[model samples]
Target: MAKHHLDPQYLDPNYEPVVNRSGNTPFGDILAARMQRRTIMKGSVGAALAGLMGAGLAGCGSDDDDDRASSSGVASTELGFKAVPVSTENRVVVPEGYSAVAFLPWGTPITGAYPEYRPDGTNSGEDQEQQVGMHHDGMHFFPIDLKAGGNSSSEGLLVMNHEYINQNALHATGPSYVNGLRPADEVRKEIAAHGVSVVHIKRDSAGVWDLVHGSPFNRRITGNTEMDIRGPLRGYHKLVTKFSPDATETRGTLNNCSMGPTPWGTYLAAEENWHGYFANKGASQPREQVRHGVGSESRYDWELADSGADAYVRFDITPGSGSAADDYRNEANTYGFMVEIDPFNPQSKPQKRTALGRFGHEGVIFAPVREGEPVVCYSGDDSRFEYIYKFVSSQPYYAATAGGYLLDEGTLYVARFNDDGSGDWLSLDLEDPDFAAKVQAAMGTTVGDIVFEGFENQADVLLNTRLAADIAGATPMDRPEWGAIDPNTGEVYFTLTNNSQRTEDQVNAANPVANNQTGHIIRWQEAGNDHAATGFQWDIFVFAGTQGTETVVDGEAVVTLDDDNIFNSPDGLWFDYNGRLWIQTDGSDDAPYQNNMMLAANPETREIKRFFVGPTGCEVTGVVSTPDVRTLFVNIQHPAGNWPDASDPRPRDATVIVTRDDGGIIGA
Candidate 1:
């Protein structure tokens, strides 16, 4: 998204023209009706909602327990640490009793010869391949013992997504271009810097964490890594590229963002804002290109490399006079899906699971997995006016044998948030009768160059996911980002980052603010406590804005923000084993809260407090902790000022490890 006073060196790849033509109701209108009914009493909206919907928000599931397959059980739901005040300082600020240390920063070597980090940004493309990439986002800590079916927190593979790169910061001075062509080596380094990093990190006997360089588990899946194309859309004609003539595979995963960990011990890195890396120069682009915001120029111009190597030129994605196999027209089509990688297998090739409907996948969050039930996961498109989605595997999940293949066949559905606070899951399956009817009704209708009639098969629907969701009448949200599932309540919460383009007439109940620069969080409960259930009940969980701001409905204050909990752009959300909802922010540093931060919340009581504040000009995102919850790892991305080390003027994005001085549980 667009940050405040964003550096000219950093590009907001997510800044694309509004492509949603869904004429369906916006979430703000739904909130309007919901607020009207609850505002009858004179109390604040938070109190009214807690009194009215608190019980429903807490599902039939029992309190926190060890039922979760990933993280350990929580001691309590309350946020144990004291709230940390926001700061504009160029250093991380945590609670008084906590310690925060930077680790695995950009260009930190982990494999090969274990090259050391060069603060001057003098690392070569080859050097970057052996080190951590830039702009860390969503991440997870997979205990090494978990591979053997044991849970040991001392050692693990810390897998994280490098969302994007800062060309100015990646190079020593800046990029060099000759007559509009970029140096091949410069382009190569940029490509190497965009992807996922798997580092083998281990804690010493004294509880200090450090990378185990050259470990077998240390690997980097960069933009040049070859990955298998899997799922329903696999082998589809649209995926045919010059590199993957058979459409069974593609080279590289770009713009990786928030991630998800599978029950079978795998990492799913989401491809977000990938379209900005490719340009379609054709006079008239296809529906896939036009709808995805592929334009005449790319963000990094990798296609304009001086060498013009196939590896670099593929970023152009322009169709040639020859067949699809002769050009890179289908290159972008191979992106925008949840890529599954086995961190434990160094030789394993990441697989793009297309069964999870593709768009700008902010991240994927699985509902608690079951032995014989379908595996269900939810992902948001991470764009203004986009829709939330859920996927239910066609095959039952067997933990002993479950793998990415289970994600290959599934029914993907988009959410439709009704004005009545009720919702339905509209299946995108071409075989579904209801979806087929919706497609038929939308056929011949055009949005830009896209003819709805062209969506004749499941592959087409999956390829053009956003358009399909539009035809299905899914509610347009305010830039839906990360989502989390509460283990205690079975309730799902998602961050609806701001949508500044929404006009007064465009306001809906869920997104009540017209020019909502400050975003909000929305939570829902699956009907009958089943994630696969077609029906749901949703409500506004919290509105993020300046303190004293009130969301008024019919001359009555519905939601009034207090000073302590005020924040903006809730981007990352995760429910720890103890059921404390951790909310991370990625927004402008010009408000009641002057910097990006992470806050902990009691999901049941809806009490929120700031826990950690990031340095100046950085996004507080991507958080995970050890199985014991005693240690927490958070990512500070694209810092403007020298953080972690003031001696280095060039700021490097990094992971910060937080631990209590008493060695107690994180957030209690």
Candidate 2:
């Protein structure tokens, strides 16, 4: 596939996204460097033998069961559950031994006095605030007991993201764009609907999870919520706006997709595909803004709201009147960073941690942390051709003193993978003259040249993270989505969710496919098995494909799907406490695969089994399990498949709680 311009048809498009338009000069440099190293290593038989036995070996039908042991020395066992059958039916289908229950559907009351959800879709903005939000995505279950070990099985605060609004199902008559403008109320409702929600939940005597109505912990952080701008870009000029004249504050977190739970007991809600919400009809957009796909037209036409309030006006990023402080031109920069929310403290203000370079952050997962050691977190830029990034805290992490403050100071680095299973993490710090020189050379221009534009400092380097990565010679990936680190090993895995734009010539040893309809999972072990290591050994763990169209690597099939387990577009990913890797998909509900589904994989044995299938038109995402491993929670998004109830006038996005019929461990 070829690179294309950002299409304004959908709010996110990242799920079915664009390719990086940046020239391939940097990638060529990486190839040249790798070829030079390959020539030297080709004659070393010992080196070749080591490479073959390295941690980077792809687990394609290999019996590496001994490598699946946890750090505590216990080996993982097989996934004993039967595979769930594939179907085009409009209901959730789980393995025969498992049971699925519809829980926390959109518009369900969580707090205050919201009227019951009307099938005709008459719920008001006020009602939605009190009720559950739409499009539930990445989430985590934070147990009430802080000291509880395992998966926090019994009760906890369920923090989740309401990604975007489905207009057709959100209103009685859908959104109305009359006379080139949207109704102010309709826009307000949409804004209120797109953010994060926190609901208190617990299991009862029957082992069914239920929402705790009117619980003090229940709250919603909508598009209008006040947020503090923390870290390097807090007082930077690029973040100045009428919302916060000093540039230390902004409003709300839009397009929240996946999330990460910090060891310090807070939640990191990622802002993905937020560029589509802005309408920057300015004469000439900034270089960074342009690189991020900010355009003249808003994706949801939210800027056309007929309201003069700053809340609605912020969506229009065009400069107006006096100076930067007098307008909301910089509002767009305030988003796209990981917003840290203290789930335990409802009164605490959410912080936008700018130290983690901004882009389309799909999600952030922390590497295993050790006391007195730097804390590391990894994230992916979901858009095609984007890069993977990691943040290393300046100070050591201590469990007792852990909090959002540690994230305030950090150095961000982008990854560049080599063909010989090795990769480098290039720091984004502009202070490093050597690093700056490499960036200049890669961009084929001097530091003060037009390529640098107005990006003069570290803040600029971070605000335009994609440009910096491109200039720094980082490797571009095919829609790198959710990432997870194996608890047993420090190995990192990223799902390169599919890129139709990747052509044959663009295919490399790592991303080895043309028109990559069924994506692949790439993993790496940090050098020395250290989370803070800047180097890593990499490999493709599994290549997702249909039953008949299997993917082969190095003369071996990485993973072969069967009739019961075929899937595509691996999106949401999570590794449970038990080390079972849960893979979720967000693909087209067509022939071979009629609906989005969730599958379980035993990484060691390279065995994947289909465990659950979502309804006809929905994407199965966000997954978590109880401490006991008996109860599992998965989110069903944009359910046009008429799941749960085919008779309902409008389909509802809800969370499905899965449990074994025998009340045993899930997927056992």
TM-score of each: 0.94, 0.90
lDDT of each: 0.83, 0.78
- The alpha-carbon root-mean-square deviation between model 2 and the true structure, to one decimal in Å, is 5.5
Quote model 1's TM-score: 0.94
Error of 2 at 354 (Å): 0.7
Clashes in each model (backbone N, CA, C under 3 Å)?
12, 6
Residues 88-143 of candidate 1 have per-residue lDDT tens digits of 89899999899999998998888888888888888889999988999999999999
- Candidate 2 global lDDT: 0.78
Assess the local accuracy of residue 325 in candidate 2 as a C-alpha lDDT between 0 and 100: 89
Q: Which whole-number lDDT from 0 to 100 does residue 541 have in model 2?
A: 69
Q: In model 2, which runs have C-alpha deviations exceeding 4 angstroms?
A: 1-19, 25-77, 147-152, 439-450, 507-513, 548-554
